[model samples]
Target: MKLAIVVGHNARSQGAVRPDTGETEFAWNSRLAKMIEEEARLFPRIRVKTFFREYCGSYRREIAEVYDQVDAWGADASNELHFNSHSSRTATGTEVLSSGSDASLRYARALQERMGAALGLKDRGVKVRRSGRGSESLMSGRAPAVLIEPFFGSSPEGQAATDEEHEQRALARSILQATQDAFL
Candidate 1:
């Protein structure tokens, strides 16, 4: 199996901001992409590809760019990495989304469960939605795809807490484990 890992946002803009740490979604996702790509090598059955390491214009454009690249790269499955944000800084957790397709949903659910458990965050569950403007064709058919928002970028304390090495490694393992289970 081949996997495409897209780091959300670009160099120009951070998807969201956490008031406390000044951390951006772009930075978080970039780090996670590196870890995930490295960890994925442990599963010999799979090959990994990365996308959107740089910014274009807006997040939607970044998503589009990732999709086109991954699609052309001929991926079996593609996952976009992101951290969530909310009006209430206290709102924090993990969320996985599918394009509402049966195959996509199955993978999304499994990934959500594994990552959520690994994260020990409030399980906000898997959500299924049709692709939209900002979504950048998550459901669009460039191999099976899902968007992973593993934590709230808006929460200062929560973001800071997971910024540790243990948490980052756990997150990468969770992603690789879920992909292994879902694909291999």
Candidate 2:
């Protein structure tokens, strides 16, 4: 099976926070997204690719590139990386969003459960993002694509944990496990 892993946004973007400092969300998200794709390379039958917009481009540019790659290789699934942020320090959980397919929902659920289990966090549950705010994901043309938010920054729960590498690893492992459970 073919897979595309997309890092949500540029780590250096304005409002981005460093996980180690309890500020930046992309610090953990981007690294973990890369880790997931790298680990997927271990499976012989899975052809994995990664997409990101960190350097000299925009999300539009990066996703366009992803679309080209997906078209070229006929990717079967896509994973978009993101982190949850909230005003209250009480919110702490993981969630996944799909375009609207049973397979997509199942994949999201497995991802939510696995990541929640790995991080000992609350399972925020999976849902279809059909409204306006998530339009980027809805129109990405990457069918069966899901966006995962595993941690909530600015939350008291988020400030409690500081091991960026360990957090990233846990999330990446869940991503790999989800892919294996579904595609492999």
Candidate 3:
């Protein structure tokens, strides 16, 4: 199977910030992307392609760039990695946003449930995002696609998790397991 991993934001337009560690969501997700690709590559018959904005152009510049890459890379499924943020520091959990397609919905649920469990986070449930967060996911892939927010970056728990040794590896494993369950 072919998979495309998208790191959520560019350097200039970084996403959420972890309160305790002062870590940017973009930096965390870039690390997760690298770890995910490294681990996923060990699986048999799996081909991986990536859209790391740090290495390429920003998705916000032209959302169509991600859509174009879906066809260009011929991915079987794709995932966009992100960390959510909110005004409330106490708010913490996991969310999976789909394109409202049945396929994507299924994929989103698998990912959301697994990551929420793995991270010991509250399950925020899977929902349709017509625009904004998961829009590029919908426009891009021919197969199932999802945007995963595994934790609240602004929350203390979220910040603490990122500080753990090999937190990126653990999250990457969560992503890979979910992807295998959904697409493999």
Candidate 4:
């Protein structure tokens, strides 16, 4: 299986920031993507590649460009990484967004289960998105794709649970397990 691991957002437009550490989603996931790629080495059958959005002039165009590249590379599946954020600072959980296709749903479910368990967060379940910020990322690719929201960075509890080297490694392992379950 060939997996495209897309780090959400860009350097110029890092998604959400963890208030306590000032870590941006782009920066965190950029590191996580590399970790996931490194973990993939254990799964000899799985080939993983990381992609970053080029902060093009427009968000829509940047997503299109990245998806185009993933398509060109002929990935078997793709996953965009992200974490949630809310003003309330209380929201917490792991959820995955899919395009509602059968294959995408499978991927979402697999990811949701693994990440929720690995992070010890509430399982928000798999959500189907036909339109919205993540819909394009999930649907534009030739292969099945899903966007992962593994915890709310704004939530102190959530951030505390995930912002650690061991937790991050667990998250990477969970992602690899999910990919194997859904595609391998």
Q: Point to the candidate with the largest TM-score.
A: 4
Task: Compose the digit string of candidate 3's lDDT tens values, residues 1-184.
Answer: 8878877877787777886777787887887888887887666666777785543555554446765676688888888888889998889888888988877887888898778767888888998988875686566657677888888988888766666757767777777777777777
lDDT of 3 at 19: 69
Give the per-residue lDDT of model 2 (tens digit) for 1-184: 8777766666557344534365455556556667776676666677677766554556566556655655566778878777777666687877788777776787787788887787777778887887665446545755577888777765657545525667666667778888778767
Per-residue CA lDDT of model 4 for 1-184, tens digit only, reads 8999999999999989999899999999999999998898888899999999998798889999999999999999999999999999879899999999999999999999999889999888999999977998987889999999999999988988888899998999999999999987
lDDT of 1 at 147: 88
Indicate the worst ten consecutive residues by lDDT in candidate 2. Answer: 14-23
State the displacement of the C-alpha of residue 70, model 3, in Å, after optimal TM-score superposition: 2.8
Which residue pairs does candidate 4 place in steric collision? none
lDDT of 1 by residue, 1-184 (tens): 9988887777787678766667788887888888888887688888888887456655555566668778888999888888888999889888888887777787788889988878778888888777453355475446888889888877764676577888888888888888888887
TM-score of each: 0.89, 0.81, 0.89, 0.98
After the best TM-score superposition of candidate 1, give how far the Cα of residue 67 lies from its true spot, in angstroms. Answer: 1.1
Candidate rank order under TM-score: 4, 1, 3, 2
Give the range where candidate 1 is weakest over 10 consecutive residues by summed lDDT.
Answer: 132-141
Model 2 CA deviation exceeding 4 Å by range: 11-23, 54-68, 159-164
